[model samples]
Target: MKTDGAEVLSKTVTQDEAAILDAWNVALLEGTSLQSGRIREAELQTQVKTVFGQLRDALASGGLDADAAGFASLRETLADISRSRAIQGFTPTDTANFVFSLKEPIFDALKRMPDGDATALAAGVWAAGKVLDRLGLQTMEVFLASREEVIGRQGQEIAELSTPVVRLWDGILALPLIGTLDSARTGVVMENLLQAIVDEEAEIAIIDITGVPTVDTLVAQHLLKTVAAARLMGADCIVSGIRPQIAQTMVHLGVELNVVSKATLADAFAVALKRTGRKVVRQQASTEGRR
Candidate 1:
């Protein structure tokens, strides 16, 4: 079942490795990370050698099935490269090209093989191209999966960082929202607010959304969910930062918050302080004492 090209290509790489490496390095360095200095030349050369060695070994064993035992190391090597490239922000095309580019050097080597005839060379080149194509596709798949995982992790980290709970007083906490509120972020807000309530024994929480660009029915619902969750934690939530435009939108949408709301964080804080039986008192200036 082995293609004539596998035997030819394997022998070409095994006997003429130096030539193959030189040719491949020239093509790889022309417009790649090595020339741009993003990746160290030595590191790139090492990865090339590792993959080239594995391909030679796998072809010598007579199979290009990526799942086959002989190709295990090659698969893992490509996977590592794909994941690294993804994390480094390289596109799938850039990552897959690492494997596809090998075809040119390999085809060139096969052409120079003295024992190879036209028919055998044709078959070998065709088979080799197929193998490289499959490997390139594999790298792309891994790159996409890794990229998605990184994006998801970053999203969670951003959500956690955005929803900060600050203790304004012994029993008062403040959460300033700066962006759109969605279900996923609302969950994070609730978790943070509830944890802060438990940790600080807070009786009042002010959710300031002055930085939110817009407020729709869904955003209002997401906010309500957070408020309800905080109330369940034995802490009443006061929504703040209701811009005039946002208030009008909420009124038009008929969104019933059913909770205390204020036009500014300061107003909400003052209300919270009053509800907590505390009020800020300005000391009157003592003219007699100054004189």
Candidate 2:
């Protein structure tokens, strides 16, 4: 049905592949942002060759209907390119342009075909454009999906980074939470605190929520759950940063924090030190008379 596409692919892959690649790269870089500096010319040429080889084989077998089973390899190659570009911080438009920009080069190459007539060349260009447009859309879909995965993984990393359990002293750990305590973050908080307790053989944990903007029923519940989990791990928890507003709100909401509460992290730390039978003492200078 699309004999023109077959002819175009056969000729381009065999004769003018290098020229088309050069033209395609010019178009790609022109459309790309400054982020393209991360990609080198040799790497781009290698990828172009790989993608064109697959597309040539697919077009030979399936003509312009490259979405058929015969073109699975071509689709797979495009998807891999999209995913790699996404991880490399390429924009969606830039990634899709990697395929779309090839249209101009392909049409230009078709014009240089020795046996190409005007009508035949027009047919070939149209067929190639249609297939590339479809592939461009597929690339965009994969790029968006990969970018979303990257964002989700980054969010998880940030959550893990923020919820650090620090050893304040022997048998004492401090978990300073600095944001909203949702169910997800609560789970992380609990896991980190419990693991730290086991690793440090900690007897006391101080959860300082001075950075938490508000204290509501749900937040209170999450705190309680963390406290319960730590107790199970043989670590008593002290909820610090109990501001007057939060304490009053907890009372009105009838949220009972069964664990001990303190008004500040220092107060909680003092209590933790006392519970662990420790105190910070200053060294006093000896009062000796000097002649």
Candidate 3:
């Protein structure tokens, strides 16, 4: 049977080599699998050659100490592969599998260390795990960033609004705040909200925070800025669904949200209708002040 390059690389691993090669395969599958099969095959072939060359070089040196050096080189090769594979479209399971496979060789290397060197090796292994975790997180972030870019290029009419958990009754745009609000997202939210306000010609914007787990002073400030920008565009922004914990944090941090209107989404809708001169009751107040 004719095997593709990826299949060829997979075939190169023996029962003994499986554990070491597993992590590299996982990383590759995670980072570059979204691309063409030919691209993935080419990248995997290069990675396998590099790792195999390292192992061959280490084994060629003749000494009792050669095994330890070989293991160290293998560990470094795994780390390199893990880092290189940190691209968008990779899954967490792949990353986890790769990291788990390293445990055995890492422990083996630590065991072979000199008496006083054991602590250093253990620390090094721990650091390597952290590096892998960071790489995985960075890969996911790149994926999200790419998604945002695609959405941006699709144009306003075709771009679908992000559905929030709650929406206003009077067609107000809803902004669902979630995760850590770094400066990058802050800018994105600002641009998106403003453009949405203009595009939809919406009179009210309801920012619902039911999904946000926590808030800091910076995030609070970002929210405030968004509200201010909306008002400048002649659109009222209502911040609703603030969690009790986030409210407390805002108070503790001494952040004042004075200008931005605060209420539940329903209440904001009521207020927005009132601002737009849409009376709940069409009939004017009776002369006796009875509806």
Candidate 4:
């Protein structure tokens, strides 16, 4: 009895081999059926070579393609066998590189399909692309999240020391203040100063106005809280970069700042040094007329 083309293509040494061969056949047929040309010249040439080689071997072994269906079956079976053998020899890294290299060919294959098949093929490719993109984004996000966790943990370590933000003169630390506060960033101001004080064991903290845009009653309260907190921690929180408008608003609001030591950044630093027992002694010159 003579075996038909489909039967010949379907034959295997074992059931497991048959299953593997069948799966490869399906994948090759599905992947290449709509592709233009025999194979993509750049990346898929190896696949082409493998398939052609296998077909030659099969032909020499007396495999016959009796009809169009039989011919297609033989062609796909050969392609599958070739692709599988080629992949089998690849190391994991090589496999990854190979896949990466195949991206263009894969895309081209989808683009060249017949109109009826194009939509379905394109849709499948698009879906696959989306899944891959999402997976890549998630991977990057996870990596960044992990890095943030490490930085946070490091921050907690320093925070444990209760070091104030003032010490940052010798280093850099970003303070991201969020939400509305009464007294115009007073508490945060104080907390940052005190943290600086403890951390740097410094006499001055530059109280930043970048975060505070207004001076309402609540703003004043918070500022007072910050000042008080700084004093208690033995740090002079220097209010810096006060906008002219904000200062006017403070005056109009009639908020007394007597209890809170005030200065433009420079004066604040001078005051800070004074409070920390560092005085700037001035030298007086004697008049020549006395001689």
lDDT of each: 0.86, 0.84, 0.57, 0.45
Give candidates' CA RMSD values in order: 3.3, 4.1, 13.5, 15.5
lDDT tens digits, residue span 86-164, model 4: 3333222322332233234334444443443544554535533542233233333434444566668775564434323
Spell out the clash pairs found in candidate 3. Answer: 30-90
Quality of model 2 by C-alpha lDDT: 0.84
Clashes per candidate, residues 3 or more apart or on different chains: 1, 0, 1, 20
lDDT for residue 47 in candidate 1, whole number 0-100: 93
Reference-based lDDT, residue 97, model 2: 81
Off by over 4 Å in 1: 1-3, 67-69, 90-94, 285-291
Q: Whole-model lDDT, candidate 4?
A: 0.45
What pairs collide in candidate 1? 5-124
User: Model 3 over residues 32-76: C-alpha lDDT tens digits?
Assistant: 343434336666657555755554344343222322554466556
lDDT over C-alpha atoms for residue 187 of model 2: 91
Clashes of 1: 1
- TM-score on alpha carbons, each prediction: 0.88, 0.84, 0.43, 0.35
lDDT of 4 at 57: 45
lDDT of 1: 0.86
Report the C-alpha lDDT of model 1 over 1-291, residue by residue, as the tens digit. Answer: 444666776777799898888888877887465655567788888999999988888888986576788888888999999899888877566677788888898889889989767877888788788889988988998999999999999988988899899999989999999899888888888888899999999999999999899898899888888888888888999999999988998898887778899999999999999999997865666554431
In candidate 4, position 29 carries an lDDT of: 40
